[model samples]
Target: MKNLGRVTPATALVLESLLSADSVWGLQIVKDTGKKPGTVYPILERLEAAGWVQGEWETSEERKGPRRRYYRLLADARPLARDFVRAQRSKASSAVRPTPAFNEGGWSAV
Candidate 1:
Protein backbone atom coordinates (compact mmCIF):
# COMPACT_ATOMS: atom_id res chain seq x y z
CA MET A 1 0.00 0.00 0.00
CA LYS A 2 1.23 3.48 -0.76
CA ASN A 3 1.53 6.26 1.78
CA LEU A 4 -1.89 7.76 2.69
CA GLY A 5 -0.37 11.21 3.28
CA ARG A 6 -2.57 13.16 5.66
CA VAL A 7 -5.28 11.31 7.57
CA THR A 8 -7.93 13.86 8.47
CA PRO A 9 -10.59 13.37 11.14
CA ALA A 10 -13.13 12.65 8.43
CA THR A 11 -10.82 10.02 6.98
CA ALA A 12 -10.33 8.47 10.38
CA LEU A 13 -14.11 8.22 10.81
CA VAL A 14 -14.38 6.57 7.42
CA LEU A 15 -11.66 4.09 8.37
CA GLU A 16 -13.42 3.33 11.62
CA SER A 17 -16.67 2.73 9.75
CA LEU A 18 -14.93 0.45 7.25
CA LEU A 19 -13.29 -1.47 10.08
CA SER A 20 -16.73 -2.17 11.53
CA ALA A 21 -17.73 -4.37 8.59
CA ASP A 22 -16.30 -6.52 5.83
CA SER A 23 -17.61 -4.22 3.10
CA VAL A 24 -19.67 -1.04 3.00
CA TRP A 25 -21.32 1.04 0.31
CA GLY A 26 -20.70 4.76 -0.07
CA LEU A 27 -24.12 5.89 1.15
CA GLN A 28 -23.88 3.59 4.14
CA ILE A 29 -20.54 5.07 5.00
CA VAL A 30 -21.94 8.59 4.74
CA LYS A 31 -24.75 7.62 7.06
CA ASP A 32 -22.51 5.73 9.43
CA THR A 33 -20.03 8.53 9.80
CA GLY A 34 -22.66 11.28 9.70
CA LYS A 35 -20.37 13.01 7.25
CA LYS A 36 -21.41 14.76 4.06
CA PRO A 37 -21.26 12.75 0.82
CA GLY A 38 -18.77 15.26 -0.51
CA THR A 39 -16.43 14.55 2.38
CA VAL A 40 -16.76 10.74 2.40
CA TYR A 41 -16.53 9.92 -1.32
CA PRO A 42 -13.24 11.73 -1.84
CA ILE A 43 -11.72 9.96 1.14
CA LEU A 44 -12.85 6.62 -0.26
CA GLU A 45 -11.30 7.52 -3.57
CA ARG A 46 -8.06 8.47 -1.86
CA LEU A 47 -8.02 5.26 0.11
CA GLU A 48 -8.56 3.29 -3.08
CA ALA A 49 -5.85 5.26 -4.81
CA ALA A 50 -3.46 4.59 -1.95
CA GLY A 51 -4.17 0.84 -2.25
CA TRP A 52 -5.57 0.75 1.25
CA VAL A 53 -9.10 0.10 0.01
CA GLN A 54 -10.76 -1.69 -2.87
CA GLY A 55 -14.07 -0.53 -4.24
CA GLU A 56 -16.31 -2.69 -6.40
CA TRP A 57 -19.65 -1.71 -7.88
CA GLU A 58 -22.51 -3.80 -6.57
CA THR A 59 -23.59 -6.30 -9.23
CA SER A 60 -26.83 -7.52 -7.79
CA GLU A 61 -29.88 -6.13 -9.60
CA GLU A 62 -32.33 -6.84 -6.83
CA ARG A 63 -31.90 -3.36 -5.36
CA LYS A 64 -33.92 -0.48 -6.81
CA GLY A 65 -31.54 2.46 -6.48
CA PRO A 66 -28.41 3.48 -8.37
CA ARG A 67 -25.51 1.04 -8.41
CA ARG A 68 -23.65 1.31 -5.11
CA ARG A 69 -19.92 1.17 -4.84
CA TYR A 70 -18.87 -1.04 -1.99
CA TYR A 71 -15.52 -0.42 -0.35
CA ARG A 72 -13.43 -2.93 1.53
CA LEU A 73 -10.34 -2.29 3.58
CA LEU A 74 -7.57 -4.32 1.99
CA ALA A 75 -6.26 -6.92 4.42
CA ASP A 76 -2.67 -5.77 3.98
CA ALA A 77 -3.60 -2.22 4.93
CA ARG A 78 -5.75 -3.00 7.97
CA PRO A 79 -2.87 -2.70 10.40
CA LEU A 80 -1.85 0.65 8.97
CA ALA A 81 -5.40 1.96 9.11
CA ARG A 82 -5.79 0.77 12.69
CA ASP A 83 -2.55 2.43 13.70
CA PHE A 84 -3.69 5.66 12.10
CA VAL A 85 -6.99 5.56 13.89
CA ARG A 86 -5.28 4.88 17.21
CA ALA A 87 -2.84 7.71 16.68
CA GLN A 88 -5.61 10.15 15.75
CA ARG A 89 -7.56 9.14 18.83
CA SER A 90 -4.49 9.57 21.01
CA LYS A 91 -3.87 13.02 19.58
CA ALA A 92 -7.52 14.03 20.03
CA SER A 93 -7.59 12.88 23.65
CA SER A 94 -4.31 14.49 24.55
CA ALA A 95 -5.22 17.76 22.87
CA VAL A 96 -8.44 18.08 24.85
CA ARG A 97 -8.27 20.48 27.74
CA PRO A 98 -10.74 20.29 30.62
CA THR A 99 -13.31 23.07 30.57
CA PRO A 100 -13.33 25.31 33.59
CA ALA A 101 -16.37 25.07 35.82
CA PHE A 102 -19.09 27.61 35.03
CA ASN A 103 -19.57 30.36 37.58
CA GLU A 104 -22.88 32.11 38.13
CA GLY A 105 -21.21 35.49 38.73
CA GLY A 106 -18.71 35.48 35.89
CA TRP A 107 -16.50 33.27 33.66
CA SER A 108 -13.18 32.19 35.15
CA ALA A 109 -10.12 30.55 33.53
CA VAL A 110 -9.70 28.00 36.34
Candidate 2:
Protein backbone atom coordinates (compact mmCIF):
# COMPACT_ATOMS: atom_id res chain seq x y z
CA MET A 1 0.00 0.00 0.00
CA LYS A 2 2.29 2.74 -1.23
CA ASN A 3 -0.48 5.27 -0.71
CA LEU A 4 -0.59 4.43 2.99
CA GLY A 5 3.10 3.69 3.29
CA ARG A 6 4.87 7.05 3.68
CA VAL A 7 2.53 9.85 2.52
CA THR A 8 1.34 11.52 5.68
CA PRO A 9 -1.05 14.51 5.42
CA ALA A 10 1.79 17.00 5.23
CA THR A 11 3.61 15.11 2.49
CA ALA A 12 0.37 14.72 0.57
CA LEU A 13 0.05 18.52 0.33
CA VAL A 14 3.50 18.79 -1.24
CA LEU A 15 2.70 16.03 -3.69
CA GLU A 16 -0.62 17.64 -4.60
CA SER A 17 1.05 20.92 -5.46
CA LEU A 18 3.60 19.20 -7.68
CA LEU A 19 0.78 17.41 -9.39
CA SER A 20 -1.04 20.69 -10.08
CA ALA A 21 1.88 22.81 -11.24
CA ASP A 22 4.78 22.25 -13.60
CA SER A 23 7.43 22.63 -10.89
CA VAL A 24 7.44 24.19 -7.45
CA TRP A 25 10.11 25.51 -5.11
CA GLY A 26 10.79 24.39 -1.56
CA LEU A 27 9.51 27.66 -0.14
CA GLN A 28 6.21 27.32 -2.01
CA ILE A 29 5.69 23.87 -0.62
CA VAL A 30 6.51 25.20 2.81
CA LYS A 31 3.79 27.82 2.33
CA ASP A 32 1.28 25.28 1.01
CA THR A 33 1.86 22.82 3.85
CA GLY A 34 2.47 25.51 6.48
CA LYS A 35 5.17 23.25 7.95
CA LYS A 36 8.49 24.60 9.11
CA PRO A 37 11.59 24.49 6.89
CA GLY A 38 12.99 21.84 9.20
CA THR A 39 10.10 19.47 8.46
CA VAL A 40 9.65 20.12 4.71
CA TYR A 41 13.24 19.62 3.53
CA PRO A 42 13.58 16.11 4.91
CA ILE A 43 10.31 15.05 3.26
CA LEU A 44 11.52 16.45 -0.08
CA GLU A 45 14.64 14.34 0.20
CA ARG A 46 12.58 11.25 0.87
CA LEU A 47 10.24 11.96 -2.08
CA GLU A 48 13.17 12.54 -4.42
CA ALA A 49 14.76 9.28 -3.29
CA ALA A 50 11.45 7.43 -3.73
CA GLY A 51 11.19 8.71 -7.35
CA TRP A 52 7.85 10.35 -6.65
CA VAL A 53 9.49 13.76 -7.19
CA GLN A 54 12.39 15.18 -9.14
CA GLY A 55 14.12 18.39 -8.08
CA GLU A 56 16.45 20.79 -9.87
CA TRP A 57 18.01 24.18 -9.42
CA GLU A 58 16.15 27.13 -10.89
CA THR A 59 18.02 28.50 -13.89
CA SER A 60 17.86 31.31 -16.48
CA GLU A 61 15.72 33.80 -14.55
CA GLU A 62 17.46 35.21 -11.49
CA ARG A 63 15.65 36.12 -8.32
CA LYS A 64 16.38 38.60 -5.53
CA GLY A 65 17.78 35.75 -3.47
CA PRO A 66 19.53 32.53 -4.44
CA ARG A 67 17.76 30.25 -6.89
CA ARG A 68 15.62 27.59 -5.27
CA ARG A 69 15.18 23.89 -5.93
CA TYR A 70 12.05 23.27 -8.01
CA TYR A 71 10.15 20.02 -7.69
CA ARG A 72 7.87 18.06 -10.04
CA LEU A 73 6.19 14.72 -9.77
CA LEU A 74 7.20 11.60 -11.66
CA ALA A 75 4.68 10.37 -14.27
CA ASP A 76 3.91 7.33 -12.16
CA ALA A 77 2.87 9.02 -8.91
CA ARG A 78 -0.12 10.77 -10.45
CA PRO A 79 -1.86 7.51 -11.31
CA LEU A 80 -1.09 6.10 -7.90
CA ALA A 81 -2.73 9.04 -6.21
CA ARG A 82 -5.72 8.84 -8.54
CA ASP A 83 -6.16 5.13 -7.96
CA PHE A 84 -5.78 5.66 -4.24
CA VAL A 85 -8.61 8.18 -4.28
CA ARG A 86 -10.79 5.79 -6.25
CA ALA A 87 -10.08 2.95 -3.87
CA GLN A 88 -10.97 5.12 -0.89
CA ARG A 89 -14.26 6.10 -2.52
CA SER A 90 -15.04 2.46 -3.30
CA LYS A 91 -14.29 1.47 0.26
CA ALA A 92 -16.44 4.23 1.64
CA SER A 93 -19.39 3.29 -0.56
CA SER A 94 -19.21 -0.34 0.56
CA ALA A 95 -18.56 0.32 4.21
CA VAL A 96 -20.97 -1.52 6.54
CA ARG A 97 -20.94 0.67 9.63
CA PRO A 98 -19.08 3.39 11.47
CA THR A 99 -15.67 2.52 12.89
CA PRO A 100 -16.02 1.16 16.41
CA ALA A 101 -12.67 2.05 17.88
CA PHE A 102 -12.45 4.95 20.29
CA ASN A 103 -9.80 6.65 22.39
CA GLU A 104 -10.35 9.81 24.45
CA GLY A 105 -14.00 9.60 25.26
CA GLY A 106 -14.50 5.87 25.79
CA TRP A 107 -13.61 2.50 24.29
CA SER A 108 -16.15 0.45 22.35
CA ALA A 109 -17.06 -3.10 23.39
CA VAL A 110 -15.16 -5.76 21.54
Runs of candidate 2 exceeding 4 Å displacement: 1-4, 83-110
Best by lDDT: 1
lDDT per residue (tens digit) for residues 9-63 in model 2: 5666666666678788999988887889888888888888877778999885756
What's the lDDT for residue 37 in model 2?
86
Report the C-alpha lDDT of model 1 over 1-110, residue by residue, as the tens digit.
89988899899999999999999999999999999999999999999999999999999999998999999999998998898899889999989987776799786657
Go through the candidates in order and give each one's C-alpha lDDT: 0.93, 0.74
Clashing residue pairs in candidate 2 are none
Per-residue error for 7 in candidate 2, Å, reads 2.2
26: Cα error in model 1, Å: 0.6
